[model samples]
Target: MEKYIQEDLDKKIILLTGPRQTGKTTLSKMLNPDYDYFNFDNPDDRLGLQEKSWDRSKKLVIFNELHKLKNWKSWLKGVYDTEGIPPSILVTGSAKLDTYRKVGDSLAGRFFQFRLHPLDLKEIHNFLNPGNLEAELDKLLFSGGFPEPFLNGTTRFYNRWKKSHLDIILKQDLIDLENVQQIIQIETLIQLLKHRVGSPISYASLSQDLQCSDKTVKRWLMILENMYIIFKVPPFHKNIARAIQKAPKFYFYDTGQVIGEQGIKLENTVACAIQKEIHFREDCFGETKKLFYLRNKDKKEIDFCTTSGDDPVLMVEVKWKDNSLSSNFEVFRKFFPQLKMVQVVKELKKEKTFPNGAEIRTAHNWLSTLTLP
Candidate 1:
């Protein structure tokens, strides 16, 4: 994580944006603990910032939560345009700093944004080696990837952390961002989405279940997306026939929050794993990468499809314990001859290559091998 941040801070103003408690501030502070630091959320600190005093000798400065300020874009434009690069600037925030910073004046070329995903196999271990991956993989699945609980490694701690995390995302984060009359309703919608994890999401069914218009349900989902509580991937159909393209599958940003069975739980875990790689690519390296799933009108489906620009490059399927190739895997291989296929099964006893030369490996080993372009 430090390497990723350090790689960009030298050349561009850096914004560390991701879900809450994903260690954006912690990582930022580690870069230069001696640097001048300000948090916009703190009224007293902001008051100090209002004075615009500067330590002329300082080589680094950190501004946290400044995105909440109305004129942050304009203010940053001045600080950056005036100060130049003596004090290399770093901005940190939770929830959509990536989107919010672009709101007012265009700070377009001023900053390089890197999404700090929760701790994962690659971040935690020697990803290339991944020695003794089983224990680490189980711990990741049980504890989820947020810093505190992941470090504490206790069910009791995770339970408390999970409760408090939800409260903050809902009561503090969501309330700050949107003014909706139904807080409890949105909370219920979060739980409903938890159940819908690893399954195709039908907005109409969700709307009917919640007794709200389909549009309202869609809006709520969007709210969750913006808040970083959940993220989704769409269906893939670029060259497929009779493809199901409308539906999406949602996955929690933290897999530990899901109460589903292990099969679905691992599916969400894998989704988050792949997503971390995707974000690192798009956010850090400026790659045109995306995650999607494959399904057809005839009900054939694969768990995920990854793309580079308009072309499909990889297809994945998740099975609880099965090591054999799936039908949809072959379907995608036949349709897209160049697509790389990976089959992840938790109980895979050994890494194997299928007849078509696709790899089947344990989730832990496979996830550890992923890297950004």
Candidate 2:
């Protein structure tokens, strides 16, 4: 079960959205188990929704993949308005529905929106038992947070699951939602991005490498992000002159997709863990939290930063060994006095202090201790 599932359902309707295969459907079923669950993917459910034949008098109703319908907004509004509070409603779908559910005025203030993500370190490990931290990280890095593959726990099963997941997203979901015609180019871009993880994205360089225009490259990147295949965090803007502008470092939602190298997968794993913490704060408690990268014209960089608007709350850097703070981070701390500095590393160390007073800890300890409020 996900922490987001525990959020209070005070609104008339709740909209649950997230990347594909992140267990949105499973959670929805958990929410309204005894009620008649309607998934639009099923032909019978589609016909029922089209004809308004489903039981409206039920105490609770769950609409799965409801956003796929053309007039999902209008239909939802009609039902929500006419039915009042007798039949509580829950709407679940991929990230595709996230936009339609939030932007349209018809659904405004009517539903609470939440984004479900793949599993993270804290979800898999018992914080009380730090004894097996090494083994836990190895397993999570090898098998991504997606429930199916993570639970299977075998190389053969993981590979087969990854191929099937990508095929469905690249060949079907992208086509159905984005109406993207350059399937081959986008697919190539996604493959290339796997190598570019934990680094700043250069559209101009990618365009030249792929023999496509910069605009095309950016469009493909955006499409992949919308599909939740990847995510990007922009540079911090607290100090404009020192911070790099408009440059975002991308990370995959699932680290298992990164083929052989454990370094990038390690960084990507930490990124996802931090992302889960911040997004939960936003979706569950309505807090303004964001993740970002810190770098300046000097080329000195830190892996990740947590912020709320212009205020930098925490600065995080991921490392595989040593667990020692870098000089670049010392300079970053001197510059941003308000932000708390933390170094998350693969190797656990007795909370060591840097020359500039930064703290270092293992990824397992840092992630396991985080709470939304």
How far residue 174's Cα lies from its native spot in candidate 1, in Å, is 1.6
* lDDT digits (tens) for residues 269-300 of candidate 2: 98898888887888777789988888777899
Q: Candidate 1 lDDT (Cα, whole model)?
A: 0.81
What range of 10 consecutive residues in model 2 has the weakest lDDT sum? 1-10
Which candidate leads the pack in lDDT?
1
- Alpha-carbon RMSD, each predicted model: 2.5, 2.8
TM-score of each: 0.93, 0.91
Over the stretch 52-112, how does candidate 1's per-residue lDDT look in tens digits? 7756467778888787777788888888888788677888888677566436777889888
Residue 84 of model 1, lDDT score: 82
Q: What is the C-alpha lDDT of each candidate?
A: 0.81, 0.76
In candidate 2, the residue pairs with backbone N, CA or C atoms under 3 Å apart (3 or more residues apart, or in different chains) clash, namely: none
When summed lDDT is taken over every stretch of 10 residues in candidate 1, the lowest stretch is 237-246
